[model samples]
Target: MVIEKAKLFENTRERWPATVYVRPSKGVLCFVAEPSLVDVYEAVEGSCAPSGEWTAEDEWTHLANWSFHQALWALAERSAERQLHRNDVTFHMFDERMRFNLSDECWNAERIEYEESPSRFD
Candidate 1:
């Protein structure tokens, strides 16, 4: 089922942790905002799915991405009519655009449509 964007956000908010934000953008069906290293580690430790097979060690980054995408796939499979490839969703971590303080109120995920970029060139 082809879900509307509004419904998709509603479902994502209900299913994912408040720390995780998912939205749709051009060329991507879903985009998970930057995640915190701590959150990723915790997910890996708590995961019961096949992604749990990965240890939060040397390749923790890859495992974190895999685990997150796996969760995304399941969510889409349940609610979306279109098939989603692993590449359809993406996420990154530790970018300068975000601060790592998990307790920060600004970290809460929400749908925000910025009227304009701070930099015109961006």
Candidate 2:
């Protein structure tokens, strides 16, 4: 269970923010962002209703929820090098099973080599 935390930054070229995960000994593992619904639910269980259901009317509403947003912001703030505020950052998490390892790193680097390349999905 290698739980990795990442601080997200605005990606002007894309819709989602961006973050780079690294190992102290190794260089950058990969760049990632856009936490999936499963990742969000696991990170902040309280965001769900009593019945363990998401109640937001739309995806925007769900992402805008204060509790969810704050939780991720807090994570990012902790890992951030500089002093950042709520709107300044967002956060995401990944594990070894995801794309935070040497194998995935190769896929990301040499994507053209493989037809079915894996994603650095959060």
Candidate 3:
């Protein structure tokens, strides 16, 4: 199943503490716990090219690309859409972009889990 769109949520108390909801073609929503931006940056920085040479910009680019892939994988695993792994998830630029605008949200907001269902959005 191809991902139609993704909704981003953030914990108000901490920076980069976020979650992403990936909606696939079958209409099932898969929730993924996203790591902090700092953590992703550090991990990408530690892995370098064969020559062991990298710049700050290169690390940032790698982090962005890797994070997107991780989100897709999370969606595939949680949605039980094993075909997504083989078919590849594609996104369109004009697709819907959703964001949860939480007011006075707490740290616990980061730990919330969404159950799978047919009428989840309805």
Candidate 4:
């Protein structure tokens, strides 16, 4: 089983800050941040949770409390580079069915893709 330890950041402009998960793909794998950490990271990513943020909310329902799975996509869009990139930066949001790791390079790319078609989300 994979384990994670993460830290929390606070920002108010985040959307659905209370209902999310995030792994920076920059450090320890299972040793992830707290629920608040997801909110904090979201804050920096341009999403702000003005009121209280999402904490103790995003939990795993299966193995090791690992309910949701997410990855970091960093491929340039609308560029010559896009053609060469087999991994779309937008293929970020994902469930455990996609994949998981203790410390995989799959997360966090130089550029990112929002996948999910970008506009199909609420």
Q: lDDT value for candidate 1?
A: 0.35
Off by over 4 Å in 1: 1-67, 70-79, 92-122
Which of the two, 2 or 4, has more lDDT?
A: 2
TM-score for predicted model 4 compared with the true structure: 0.20
Separate clash counts for every candidate: 1, 0, 0, 34
- Scored by TM-score, the top model is 3
User: C-alpha displacement of 110 in model 3, angstroms?
Assistant: 24
lDDT of 1 by residue, 47-104 (tens): 4345546542323333333445455544443442333433333332211112232225
On residues 1-122, what C-alpha lDDT tens digit does candidate 2 reach at each position?
A: 11112211122112223332312222342212244423544543443365655553222223323333444444543453333233433333222212222245544532232224333444
Better of 3 and 4 by lDDT: 3
lDDT of 4 by residue, 13-113 (tens): 11213332333443554333334434444444432233546422231112112212133222111222113212222222232223453224654330122
Q: What is the C-alpha lDDT of each candidate?
A: 0.35, 0.32, 0.33, 0.26
Error of 2 at 79 (Å): 12
Give the least accurate 10-residue stretch of model 1, judged by summed lDDT.
Answer: 110-119
Candidate 4 has its poorest 10 consecutive residues by lDDT at: 5-14
| lDDT preference between candidates 2 and 3, better one | 3
lDDT of 1 at 50: 59
TM-score of 3: 0.29
